[model samples]
Target: MLTPLQKTTIRATVPALQAHGDTITRTFYARLFAAHPELLNVFNPANQQTGQQARSLAASVLAYAEHIDRPGLLAPMVQRIAHKHVSLDVQPQQYRVVGQHLLDAIAEVLGEAATPDILSAWAAAYDELAALMIDTERDLYHTGTEQPGGWSGFTPLRVTRLTPESSVITSLTLERPGGEALPPYQAGQYVSVKVKVPGDDHWHIRQYSLSAAPNGQQYRIAVKREDGGVVSTHLHDRVREGDDLLVHVPAGDFTLRAGTRPLVLLSGGVGVTPLLAMLHAALTDTPQRPVTFIHAAHNRAAHAFGPEVRALAAQHPQLRTLVFYTDVQDTDQLGLPSHQAGFITAATLKPALPLDADYYFCGPTGFMATVEGILDELGVPVTRRFTETFGPSQQFILPAAALAAPI
Candidate 1:
């Protein structure tokens, strides 16, 4: 709990946080890594190198400060972050290390402006937030461990099979060494895969969405070969059948909701992994539920699971799928015969969209932004819009007027 004075002080610091949050977060990460180099094994090197992590932290801090008194507004953000933390097996002690470096960076950056009163208030605020996160993550950890066939921390699983899904995407099927049953997970959840490249000294961990509906026998994750991604490249080029990999329990908050309302699923590039799982689960669990699955890819070569989805649609009368090939070749048949040859637009989507449906989408930033804008223009209720981003969480910005108006 924060005193009224602390809340006021936090509110007063929002402007400064907005102005220098990025620099503060960058400095915090530098100091944190310098003091605790081992943390590098836990964090994404690419996100750090690109400063995406820093920017994300900065935005989160600013939002926290701005809404210090109204924590309810940040529930969704907190839930998302807590799930990510649990996926990484983040411990409570890490909060202390992060908070220390964060405050030090703030003091270093603000200098004269970071007075005793301001620093004190900020420290309390950080403590409150940290406690909340710790509690939330504790619950998540407990829930995961309580599930049947569940275990804490990372477990070694053997890669039983591998199939190339597309030019860049390959799906690996993993099972326990002794063929023990695996824990079930909600569709759209992801597991963290930890690997050490043959010559690398430190382990690298990356989260990949489970591409298949949960079965007690095995878990499947689709890896997209990234240009210079350490873990991804290793998974693509070095990992093979009979190899063992450390995998964490599945964790994510992007699962399908419990409702009979029409469900809309949209994806782009490799973002289709989780949604594909959702599609399978929805069809299996509720065959009568109407589902619209929309996906976009550069071309057929880049598209994954097209045949599988098409086959499923053929079998299920309630399932509708739309594919968009942005760079269609002359050889590219529209549609698989039904596919459109351009991007997803309002005009293209209006016919298939259900105005009263629940919308869930995952994709590249630009594609998601376009979809969000279209959904907003179509008068989709904000409560019905759910999205998942691949890397560091991103907040979609709406027009000023939209922000001011009630949903």
Candidate 2:
């Protein structure tokens, strides 16, 4: 436990943290990789190169300092990080390495400002946070291993089949070589795929949402070919059926809640993967429940699972799907029940959406921000709106009007 002086010191450094957070994180990563080059195999090179990981770490550190006394406020953030850590098979000892480099970076950046008292306070704070994370991850690891058909760490699975979903998206069906039953997972959970690219010395790991509902026989994940993405490009261009890949147990917190309220799912681009699973599971479990799925894509060619979603909608009267195509082709059919040109706007959503429905959306940062703002304008309660970002934790900047409104 932090003494009163330490807590006061941490709170007083909030401004400095905000100002130098990014620099500190960048320095930390540089120092960490220099001293422990093996860690490169465990982290995303793309995210690191683009500075996304550094920015995310910086934000997290600042938030932790600001909420040191009220740790309850950090529960959501902690849960998200813990899940990600477990998916990566992060070991407890790595925290010590990280803490050392982080503190060194802070001191190197702040120079004289980082006095012995402040440094000591920060070290104790890091230990406290690290202990919490370690405990949470231990519980998660236990639950995952204890579950039926679940295994700890990465397990090798053979890719049984590959199906193209769209111009840029493809689905890979994976199953155990021994044809054993697979563990069940929540509809929106994701699994980390670990692979060593042909020429690379290190491994690359990426998390893809399980695009299909649990079948107990196999697992399906949809991969979108991202530009210059190491794992994605390798999966799209080189990985093949009959090939084996290391996959972690399913883990995530962005899942569908069991309830009787109307369900509204919104997605942009490849974010539709998890929402698709939720739709399938929800329909199968509660066919009578009303569900509205809204998806935004570039065009018909970019829209995945279009035929399957349309077929399901045709078969179920309670299901409604609305597709927004930003760039409609002349060959695309208009006036269809599911087709709409342009992006999702308040004008389009207000007429059909239920105010009391549970809203779940995932997509590009801009798209989610817009959806949140629109939901706020529609007077949807904060508790009913849920979202998931694909990569790093990006803060959703609400519109000016929405910010002014009461929570």
lDDT of 1 by residue, 1-407 (tens): 89999999999999898889889999999999899887886888888998888988887888788778767667777888899999899999999999999999999999999999999999999999999999999999998898888889889999999999988999999999998889999999999998888888887789999989888989999999998888888999899999999999899988988788999999999999999999999999988789999999998888999889999999998999899999988777773556888999999999988759989899777888899899988998777888887888655222244345553
Error (Å) of candidate 2 at residue 265 is: 0.3
Q: How many steric overlaps are in each model, in order?
A: 3, 0
**What are the RMSDs of all candidates, in order?**
2.7, 3.1
Encode model 2's per-residue lDDT on 1-407: one tens digit a residue. Answer: 89999999999999998899889999999999999887876777878998888988988888788778777667778888899999999989999999999999999999999999999999999999999999999999999998998999999999999999999999999999999989999989999999998899888788999989899989999999998888889999999999999999999989998987899999999999999999998899988789999999999999999998999898989998999999999877867967899989989988778658999999877888889889978888887887898788855222344345553
User: Candidate 2: where are CA atoms >4 Å away?
Assistant: 396-407
lDDT of 1: 0.89
The 10 consecutive residues of candidate 1 with the worst lDDT sum are 394-403
For each candidate, what is the lDDT?
A: 0.89, 0.90
TM-score of candidate 2 relative to the true fold: 0.95
Instruction: Give the winner by lDDT.
Output: 2
lDDT of model 1 at residue 69?
70
